[model samples]
Each structure stands twice: as C-alpha cells, then as structure tokens.
Target: MYERVEEMIQGYIWKDLGVKVIEAVDGEVTLHMPVKTRQTQFHGNVHGGVLATLADMSMAAAVNTLVEEKEFTVTAEIKVNYLRPAAGDFLEAKGKVIKRGRTLSHCQAEVFDDSGKQVCFVVATFYMFKKE
Candidate 1:
C-alpha cells in the first residue's frame, strides 16, 4: 500500500515539485529532491519556498497513505521553520503524522541537506474531505 501511494505521487505530482519518495511506512514518508541551479535564491542558497513545498508534499503523501480511499486531503495550514542555509547536492524530507482526526490530520516534516544536517522543519494540518 505504501509503495502504491509512493508511486502514485512520484508518477503524478512530485515531478512538478522536484521530489521523489525514497521510503514510506505506516506513519512516515521519506523523500528526496535535488538542489539545482534553478532552485537557488539570489543569495545562491536553496530557496525557502522549495523547502516548504517539499515538506508539504511529503506530509500530504504521508496523510494520503493513511486516509480512506474515498477521501482526499488538502493542506489547511502549514508552518515552515528554516533552521539553516541549504546548499549542496540534494535535500531530504521526512514526514510523519502527529495526529489524525475524522475531518483533519496533522503532520510534521523535516528537511535535511546532503550532509545529513537539518535545514528546515514543518508542521501542517490537512482537511480530509470525503469523495463524492
């Protein structure tokens, strides 16, 4: 189930965000995204928006794996904390569910640089809507 969800996200939405899932479990999702020239800011560091997008995507994917098939989730709120400058080979984002409710879910994501150092952290709440 996790692999299926991962593939669905990779084959669908993640290319737009430049992300891919490396691992997924019951409560967690691990993703990787490259920090290329186009992704850098004026100061030459990876842009904060890119980091936030990766974090949000990771959390959404994690929530998707746990929710019912007939339900879809959308981001209700997201807060990102840029802990340090990000530059180098790639970025890693790991997301896990912190809480889950009938109509909403809360998840957290952390991004790391290629050297395995933390770069950013995010907490997101999602609204789960039933499919019609």
Candidate 2:
C-alpha cells in the first residue's frame, strides 16, 4: 500500500518539489527532499514553506494508512515550529499518527537535516472523508 501511495505521489505537485517517500508503514511515513538552491531562501537555508510542505505530506501519508480504501484525508489544521535553520544536502520528515478517530486523525512530524539535527516540528489534524 505504501509503495502504491508513493507512486501516486509522483503524479502530484509533491513530485515537482522533489518530495519522495522513503519509508512507510501502518500509521507512519518518512519523506525525503533533496535541498536545492531553488528551494532555499536568500540566506541559503531551506525555506520554511518547504519544511511545512514536507511535514504536511508526511502526515497525510501517515493518515492515509489508517483510512479505509474508499476514504481519503485532508488537512484540517497544521502547526509548525521552526526549531532551527535548515541547511543541508537533504531533509527528511518523519510522521506518525498519534490518534485516529472516525473522522479525524491527529499526527505529528519532525523535520531533520542530513546531519540528523531537528529543524522543525509539526502537529496536524486531518479529516477523513469517503469518496462519492
């Protein structure tokens, strides 16, 4: 299932941002993005928006694992904290579902640099909906 989701992501905007799922299991996912000048700020640090996107994508993927085949999830709310400047060859975001309810899931994610230093943390809520 994770592999299929990873392939599906390639057709989305995440592919344009160079985001890829490196690991995934029930209720958990890890995504990687190679740092590039195009994704950085004037200071050469990775942009906050990029980090947030990584977090959001990872969390969504984690939530995906808990949803039924006919259901999908959307971000209800997300909060990100930039703990440190992110400057590295690559970035990784690890996400896990903390709680799952009938219609909502609570998730958390952490972004780390290539050196394994934590750069950002995120908490997000996702709402699940069935396909019409």
Candidate 3:
C-alpha cells in the first residue's frame, strides 16, 4: 500500500511540490520536501500555501491508509495555525487520523523545519468517496 501511494504521489500535485512519502502505516503518514527557492516568498520564508499543502497532503495520505483500494478521500476543510517562520533546507509533515467514520475522517498534521522546530499545525476533515 505504501508503494502504491508513493507511485500515485508522483503523478499528483505532490510531484510538482516535491513531496515524498517517507513512512506510511496504519492511519498515519510522514512526508518531507526540500525547501526550494520556488516554494518560498520574497522574504525567503516558506510560503503559507506551501506549508498548508504539505499539511493537507499528509493528512490525506493518512486517511487513504484507512480506506479500501477503491475508495478515495478529499479535503473537506482545513484549519492551519502558522506558529513560526519556516526557513530551512527541508521540512517534514506528520499526519495521523483522529477518527474515522463512515463518510468523514478527522485528522491532524504538524509541519516542522529541518531544525525540528514546528512551523505549522493543522486540523482537517476529509470526506471519503468511491471511485466512479
């Protein structure tokens, strides 16, 4: 399942963002991405959108682990708190499922810079659906 998810990441928006799945098990996932110039703002800090993307992707990946092969999930809503400036060569996002329901999943994620300082925290809800 981890290999399949890794392969799917290569074809999604994650490919453009350079996100790589480092670990995936049960209802948890860990991902990392290098801090490239293109992902930063003019002030040289990682952009909020990029951090949010990392959080979202990680949470979605966690949700995926709990669903069937034919099932998929979508981000229904996400709330993020930017705690500090993300300035580093790389960042890691860790996500875990808080609850899994018949149609919805509650998840949380945290993003940290290479220094191990947390840069952002996120809580999200995902809706599960079957492939058409």
> What is the C-alpha local distance difference test score of each model?
0.87, 0.89, 0.91
lDDT of 2 by residue, 1-132 (tens): 564466558666687878878988999998898988999999889999989988998998888877776778899999999999999899999999999988989999999999999999999999988996
> How much does candidate 2 score in TM-score?
0.93
Candidates sorted on lDDT, descending: 3, 2, 1
TM-score of candidate 3 against the unseen true structure:
0.94
Off by over 4 Å in 1: 1-13
Residue pairs clashing in model 3 are none
Which RMSD does model 2 reach against the true structure?
A: 1.4
lDDT measured at residue 132 in model 1 versus the true structure, 0 to 100: 73
Per-residue lDDT of model 1, residues 30-54, tens digit only: 9898888988999999999989988
TM-score of 1: 0.91
**lDDT (10s digit) by residue, model 3, range 58-128:** 99888888888677888999999999999989999999999999889999999999999999999999998
